[model samples]
Target: MQENKKTIYSWALYDWANSAYATTVIAGFFPLFFKSYYSADVAATTSTAHLGFASSISSLVIVLIAPLLGSIADVYSLKKRYLFLFSYLGILMSAMLSLVGAGEWQAALFIYILGNIGFMGSNIFYDGLLQSVSTKKSVDFVSGLGFSLGYLGGGVLFSINVWMFQDFEFFGFEDQATAIKASFISVALWWALFSIPLLLFVKEDKSTHISTTTKLKDGYLRLKKTFSKIRQLRHLSLFLVAYWLYIDGVDTIIRMAVDYGMALGFDSSNLILALLLVQFVGFPATLLFTKISEIMGTKGAIYLAIAIYLFIIMWAATMMEVWEFYMLAIMIALVQGGIQSLSRSYYSRMIPEGYSAEFFGFYNFIGKFAAIFGPLLIALVALVSQNSRVSIASISILFIIGAILLYFVDEKKGEKELKDALT
Candidate 1:
């Protein structure tokens, strides 16, 4: 029992550790820094296009690799090692961002890709740890706890960086760009420092004891078999497809919202504060959703989240005042982490534990693929309409469509199938 508690805490700490990178580098400062510093010599639209393309390309690579790596980890029992490897990769790449300066678009793109590879790749293995760490009854709460801690940690570091950016001269930085670059250094330090507890305490599952050569062969075969089995599990397959669509929209929103704010004439300070609000808001809101799930069940909680997202997208589309953005931020705070945490738990509950990693690979695969459509769609709409607001508003259709499909999924039936697989 003590070991279990230690494992749970370690898993949660990893979430806290990596979220600094997600919040500061991915969501907060990097996009602004990329546009302002790297694209100072380029047109605004061109810069936006470049950033969008860079993200799309990196996501494309992750989509291709995640499932296979997931399958391999499941077969080989190397999930922990892989997690550490990718974590270091991401941390090092993020730290290197301190080197980016004016007229460094190509260099920025290069490091961003490496950093994202580390981010996305590490998550595949991190998620694979879920089944090994907790039982079915506790999974949702623990998952929510991890996400909540992540938000808290990321928010704290981001708040510090916000202060640093506000007072750049004290650091002897010439401008906000240099100070913002320093924020990347903080992200690296915070992530590395916080990850230590998890690395020390969490033990990898050793149940899968296949020989190395056999493991490699079996992993490939298993990948092929999963494709066929996925077809047989029609409800699970459909849910994944539906999740892929809506989650893409959610991810796109989180990734692009700050950039959209910048484009919409929101002051940098306001944008940073709003993002910080999301971080803080996500911490408790995620736990609330987990409790709500106990009464309403996972599917119901997801439906609630989808409803909230629909409202947010529409609100964003029509928002005329800066205060409206704050309202939208509150709405996101209410749903974002909860939705993601529930989604992971829901899917885990449906899969057999032995194959959790492989199924999660498919989960990661669908998630990465889902990321492609919303951003591409946003870019396409922005290019055609020359309006970021319209592009932003266009994302609402994903949630609406996803919700409609989710209504057809019978959770009772899914539960029965999962039980049968275990027995």
Candidate 2:
């Protein structure tokens, strides 16, 4: 048990390491910097549209490849190698963000897509690492710990970047653009520095069943076989479908909420503060919700999380003040990590051991595909309404529909099926 705890902590540290990319590169500085510096020289909204399109394209590619890569890793016991490969890909691209210059919109977009692909692809393998590290009893708490540490780590680095962006002159940078670009360098360095623990400590299982060449071939073939077998797992399939829709809403909110706040005239400081609040608040709340899941079970906790999300959407729609935005941030922090952690743990509980990577590949398939709709919806609505606030409000429908479907799922039955399959 002590060894398991050590392994879990090591696993969670990777979350701590990489989340800086999500917070700084994805959420905090990059978008604003892109628009102000790299994209400003381009035609209006072309940069924004290009970013969306690039992300969408990369997401689609990852969706197609994730299952195959996961299957290959499982068959050949190459999970750690895959994790390193993708993590380095992200690191290389993140480091390249510092090189983006004015009038280099195409290059910027290409780098962003590469970085995003690396970020998303690494997560597929990182998530698969969970099965090898811990059992069902510890999954929720450990997953929550990862998210909590992620929030803490990402927030700390982002706060530093915010300070730098606000005070660029202190560092001999001429302006915000230079500081922001430098922040990308920091993100790359920080990610590389912190990732050492996991790479050093975590061990991959050995698979004697297949050679490397055959593993590659069999991985693709197994993906086809798994797709057909998915039909046999009715309840699990339904849950994946439901998770796909609802998690889309969640992902959309995380990606676009800051942009929405900025559009509503909130200053960068306030936006940063709000995000910081969410990070700190998420830390404890995530652990508490994990405990609640132990008492109430995964489905119940998820239902509660979905309910909270509904309230946040309604609250945001009616918000007219900065304080109100802060309030909403608190609400999101309380449930966001919990929902995501519990969902992953719940799904893990339902999958058989030998096929964990394959099953989670389908899980990633849903996740990647789900990520598409909300952003596209936001972009489309912003295009039509020219009102980012109103566009964001439209996300409520996803939560409502997701919550209703979640109610129909039988958690006990899913657990039974998973155990039977293992036996």
lDDT of 2 by residue, 253-356 (tens): 88777767766777767877788788888888989899999888888999899988988988887788999989999999999999999999888887767777
Cα lDDT of model 1 overall?
A: 0.84
For each candidate in turn, the TM-score is 0.95, 0.93
**lDDT of each prediction vs. the true structure?**
0.84, 0.81
Q: Which residue runs does candidate 1 get wrong by more than 4 Å?
A: 1-3, 206-215, 415-423
Number of clashing pairs per prediction, in order: 0, 0
lDDT accuracy of residue 35 in candidate 1: 74
Candidate 1: 10-residue stretch with minimal lDDT: 414-423
Clashing pairs in 2: none
Clashing pairs in 1: none
